[model samples]
Target: MMFKKIGLFVVIVIVVLIGVMTFNTFTNTADDPIFEVVEMPAIDTNAVAARLSEAVRIKTISTDVGDPPASAEFDQLHLLITSAFPLVHENLKRDVVGDHSLLYSWEGSDTSLPPALLMGHMDVVPVEPGTEGDWEEDAFSGAIKDGKIWGRGTLDDKLSVFAILEAAELQLAAGFKPKRTLYFAFGHDEEIGGENGAGKIADLLEERGVKLAFTLDEGMVIVQGMMPGVEEPIAFIALAEKGYLTLKLTATTEGGHSSIPPKTTAIGKIARAITRLEENRFPAALNSPASDMFDTLAPHMGLPLKAIISNRWLLDPLLVSELGKGGATNAMVRTTTAITITESGTKDNVLPSTATATVNFRLLPDTSIDDVVDHVTKVVDDPDIKISVKQGNEPSRISSKSGEGYQLIEKTIRETLPDVLVSPGLMLAGSDSKHYETIAENSYRFLPMRFGPDDLSRVHGTNERIYIDSYVEIIQFYRRLLENTGG
Candidate 1:
């Protein structure tokens, strides 16, 4: 009789668990929207591509932080903007913030409505020294070939600046004046820290007491074949950004010859510290933006994965394990550590007296710089090693997935792409959007550009390019966005 009771109890427990999982899985899809691709009027794709190509050719490369930018190149870019976008130049109020960053304010019919801001950077990172040969075209040539525009800034960002101005220019030609004020910001040093450019712009806006209703910049993209289980393209709009931290570690030890070396030299100590950092990594957690992402994608995913994600309350560990497998996906789940640079002995035979290493950490949203310092100190367990923060910031405050800024952007993306799925994600890298988040009610980071799996390495790597048709879509997306907000 006891065995019979036990069997019945087990069966009841299984039934209850299955019932809960099924409920969660079915309800996960309540918010998914289906839309038919709507037809739109055509633009001159060739002319737009030519303008983007011309913008890409000018090298407005951002030097290291605190260093002066390329003045001549930026001057050439400004001239191109003035000449290419006569409507925008004539109608908008332009301010050259911090010399290179440009801010344009377009007055609206109703000044009482809070203003909307659109931003993109004009600067591109320099091509790696030895990898220039690996590029299919000259890194700065902006060659239009094989149905694509080839160059550095073509993908990294000059496309955004051109797209915004082009969209506004077209809208103005159509005699469309916005109901809400609009601001266009083009920062020149976003590739570096953005301190002198976007940072100053944010400060200026704050000084003027200009409270922005919303701000949009680049962080996520419309990606294909990157996420598993979903066969269609995803418009991954990142609502939060991982914080960045650079820690410099230095160690000093007794000077000695190689033959009379102590048990552990300075270099050895630093190496052990790094090994400790790597081996004992930050604990993985299925945190927000990530959790929110899976929840949004769950409805669109395949069978077992969908079931698992929706029931994260019961299967959190399993979901974390699966998502933590890939390098890109792993970044979404936990803080990442990379030992970028190290220095030790001056000569081969001598024991080094001093050793230094540079460590870069991308902090998860819940982790702070102080928390990292404390963790590293405890894990390394070394008194002789001195750790100093080179530069860092806590993760961005999570933006609202349901905010007006996000809703408008999502609507614009859905209308623009029609077939793509939209989901909130965690941005793995930093962008100029961080600086502007302070003054805006909500700041969103999504570039309307579509990227495939193979395109990931090309951004700051070789053969960075954007398709001509893709550039056309970007212009369309921005135009729709402008129209949605106030055009």
Candidate 2:
């Protein structure tokens, strides 16, 4: 009887071991599909470098609408586009909307499908007058050196415009035709808020009863050391962007001499209000596109981190707390507030009659401007301080993750960059796509390039540059994207 009991226990232990082995094998096999690389045509590095240089030389800097320079530069850039991409000009139907918006439609073989929009901006921000001396080469020179292309728009967005055209020109030369119609919308005033450019273009297309399958713009890029627990570089595709809100906090009291002042002056009240705002920030939640980013990257991460990310429901609060320790990661999970401008007393000796502070808020998705105003009002609590929303907008609608738009993007990135992991994220900054939210169902913001942290800082900063290899990769990415729209 003792021998038989021992034998039964041994059999049960062996059975349990087999079950564990099978489960591990299945899970490991599941991860294999995630790592498979896609095939794409070879990229032309020299052509990409030459084209980027040509684009930067045009000085398509955006000027204030009232200035004569604005319209002149817009027209020159438009002419340059036509002259450079002859195949696109000859094949696609081009239309000029508003003052400087350019729209090109490439008719697909199958007219039944909705068109895909490849959106970019041609105009760049103006450089500061005194900062020109800080550049390694002339900001407008478009110098190619040290294996990188240096210029103003190389990172902010001329890369997108140039890459899209280069890819289309190359594909047209190779006799490749897409099944779904492609529309290239280039806005002229994206830096100054895209009102006459992308806004008008989206309106024009909507009037024609056209609904886009998807619209891609410039926002996020590939980054290393971006997220914790991820060793490999991550390519963040922005599926949503936060809203911009500006608030004016004002405190009013009777003016008096500084020698005999009230216990709480206007400046004191305003300062206290700002302190409350900074102390009390919006609660972070794991929702929207940023959560999707972690979900997609989980399997690719190491064991302990992967397990935590894969089971986010059990560890979300803890994960958010951990991410909050870093500045970049904290921005991913919460609405952020910064006091940009403050005005108070006119004179040092006299007590000011009024004090005003301007605070900028980048609101998370699902957070309304009204909600933010209420939160700020509650936090300040003092009756002397008044909080009002000066300028505000609700966050843009989130794009679908499972739709044809996302899949095509993933496929394109996979083909062009087999090594990098693609994931969806929320953009912290505003883009021209915000203007199309009412009409378009899906709008995505991504630029195809892999760069480290320093490379990212160059954008909208001094010494903006792009690797020649990265430019070539972007060209291949667009080519694959146009070719695979039907498949």
Candidate 3:
């Protein structure tokens, strides 16, 4: 009788556990609002593509060192802007900030409401030396073939710069002005550190006592075959971007012959330090941006994934561990360490007195530079190794998805691309949006264009291009966004 009663209780417990999991999975659906589809007005897409191609042809390249490049290229592009978009140049008050950076203000009817700002960079990284031959079209040709505009800046940025101007020009033609103010910021040196361009612009705006409702800069995009379990294209609207920190590590010891080394050579010591850092990674968790993303997309996923995601209380450890497996997804969870540059002995046969390595870290939103320094110190516990930060910036603040400006952008995406699911995400890399934290109430990072898996390498790689239709879609998305702000 005791055995039978115990078996009955076990069976009941199993059934209840299953019942709870099933209920949670079913209820964990996306809270997507139904949006009415918008009809796009006929646009001269050919003209738009031609304009973008012209912009790309100008070699407005920026480098890691000295740039807001003192060249005639930026001047030529500025001339094109003034000539091509007559209405925009005539009406929107334009200011030349930080040498080559451009800022345009379109005064709205109402002065009480804070403004919305859109940003893009005009600078493009130079084509690598030997790889120039690998391109299907000339690197600066701006060739339009197979329904694509091929060039360096076409994807990395020129699209946003042209798209915003095109949308504003179109709206101005229709005699429509925003009720809330709008600003267009075009940074000239974002390819580098952006210290001279967007950074200065932010300072200037702050000095003027201008606070924004929101600011949008290009970062994430609509992607396919990237997120796990979801097959369709989903848009990642990055709520925050990862912080950047680069540390230079050095080791010093008594010089000696390679055969007659001390207890450990400098090279070996630094190498061991780097290996320790790689092996012992930062703790992983399904934090916001990632956590927010999963919650939004959970309902769209398969049953197993949905169950795992919804029942995080029971399965967070397993789920978080699995998330750290993929290269791209792994960056979404914890601070990532990468050994970029290393230098050792001049003559391989000689034991070097000093060895050095440069390591880069992309910190998660919650992680600080000092926190990273402490982690490295603890992990690489050798007193012989010295660590110093070369350059660093803390992560951007997480913007609200429920904010009015975010919803305005979200609704625009829904209306323009009705089929794509939009979700909050974390940007793995940096952007000019980092500088606008103080001047803007919230900052968003997204470009409404479809990107596939392989398109990742094409940005600064060979065959950099943007689809003509995609370019048109970007223009329409911005137009819809600007129209939505006409309260």
Candidate 4:
């Protein structure tokens, strides 16, 4: 009887082990490619380089529209666009909104369906004074060297502006018309707030009773070594972008000498508030977009890490914790806060009567600005500290994961870059797409530039450049996207 009981237990254990192994094997098998062959059009690299350089030469810096309507740079940019892409100017109906926003409408063959809006900003942030010498070539010179295009807006956005127009021009040359209308929106004030550019453009479209199918804007880029557990490069599409909110944490007290100060001075109070907000951050949750990013990339990932990420139910906490370790990965999972600017203390010896610290908060989706402000107040727990939030825009709504819009984008990406895996992730930075979020059901941010690790740093940094090969590839990617639009 004892021997028989032992045999039954052994059988049960062996059966359970087999079942576990079988389930693991089935779940971990790599899936087949999402899309079949997508025809890629021939792109002219030299032409693209020439056009990009021309764009860089005309400085479209967005300045405060004072009485005279900012600088002549905006007008020069407009003229440059018309000269660069004659086909676009001839075919598309262009509308200038507010001060410098350019909205071009290419009426599709079928006007019944809503149009697809390809959005980008033409303005580049001001190059810091006296830093132009740091560049190998002039920042505004639009120099091309070593098979790369060097300039200010090359990566920050002028790439998208030119790339999309190049695609449109190619399509026009091929006599390919989109089934649905295509709208190209170029905002001039995205670097500052888009109040005058994209914001007004969205209002105009809304007034016309025109709704967008999807709007693509400039945001996250494809960078190698961006994430752990993934071997190959991952293309992170910005399905939703975090909102921008500025909170002013101010503390006022009686001014006194620095030598004879209160237990906590005005600066000390503001500093403490910032420190608390940083230490006690918003809780990290693996929301839909982030989860989808992991799920899509998991199969492509290498090794035991793949197995772990693929099976989120088994170890979700571990994955989130690991992601929280790094800045880039942590930005993917949670809202981030940084003390960007502080205005406190006038004289070195005097404890000023008031100290103000500007806290810039990148809010997560579904999280309100009010909630963030309230959280900050609660965390600081100081009745003396006054917290006021200004110029807050809620995070853009998350677009559809399984829809024609996403399918089209995914298919185009798969066709253009077969090696890189396509995944959806939240953009930590805000973009012009936020303006169209209310009008468009789906908005995605993707630029088909295959950038290695170091290449990404050039964005908004010294020695900004884009490889000639990457530039050509982006043109091809846009071409494929345009060709596939009607189909």
Local distance difference test values of all predictions, in order: 0.89, 0.83, 0.91, 0.82
lDDT-sorted candidate list, best first: 3, 1, 2, 4
Cα distance off (Å), candidate 4, residue 173: 1.5
Candidate 4 or 2, higher lDDT:
2
lDDT of 3 by residue, 343-396 (tens): 989896788999999999999999999999999999999898899999999998
| Regions of candidate 4 where Cα sits further than 4 Å from its true position | 1-22, 63-71, 257-261, 346-351
On residues 257-278, what C-alpha lDDT tens digit does candidate 4 reach at each position? 9898889888888888888988
Q: lDDT tens digits, residues 421-473, model 2?
A: 78889998989998887667799999877878688667777898888888888
Measured by TM-score, how close is model 2 to the native structure? 0.91
Kindly report the root-mean-square deviation of model 4 from the true structure over all alpha carbons.
3.3
TM-score of predicted model 4?
0.91
Which residue pairs clash in candidate 2? none
What are the per-residue Cα lDDT tens digits for candidate 1 across 1-487? 9999999999999999999999988888747655445445688888888988898889898768877899999999999999999999999999999898999998889889899999999999999899989999999998999999999898889999999999999888888889999999999899998888899999998998998988999889999887888988999888889999999999989987998889999999999999999898888889888888888888889899999988988999998888777688889998988999999898878999989999999999889999999988998899999999999988898889889888888888888898788999899999988898889988888997889888879998899999988888988888888888985
Better of 3 and 4 by TM-score: 3
Of the candidates numbered 1 and 3, which has the greater lDDT value?
3
Best by lDDT: 3
Poorest 10 consecutive residues by lDDT, candidate 4: 62-71
| Ranking 1 against 3 by TM-score, winner | 3
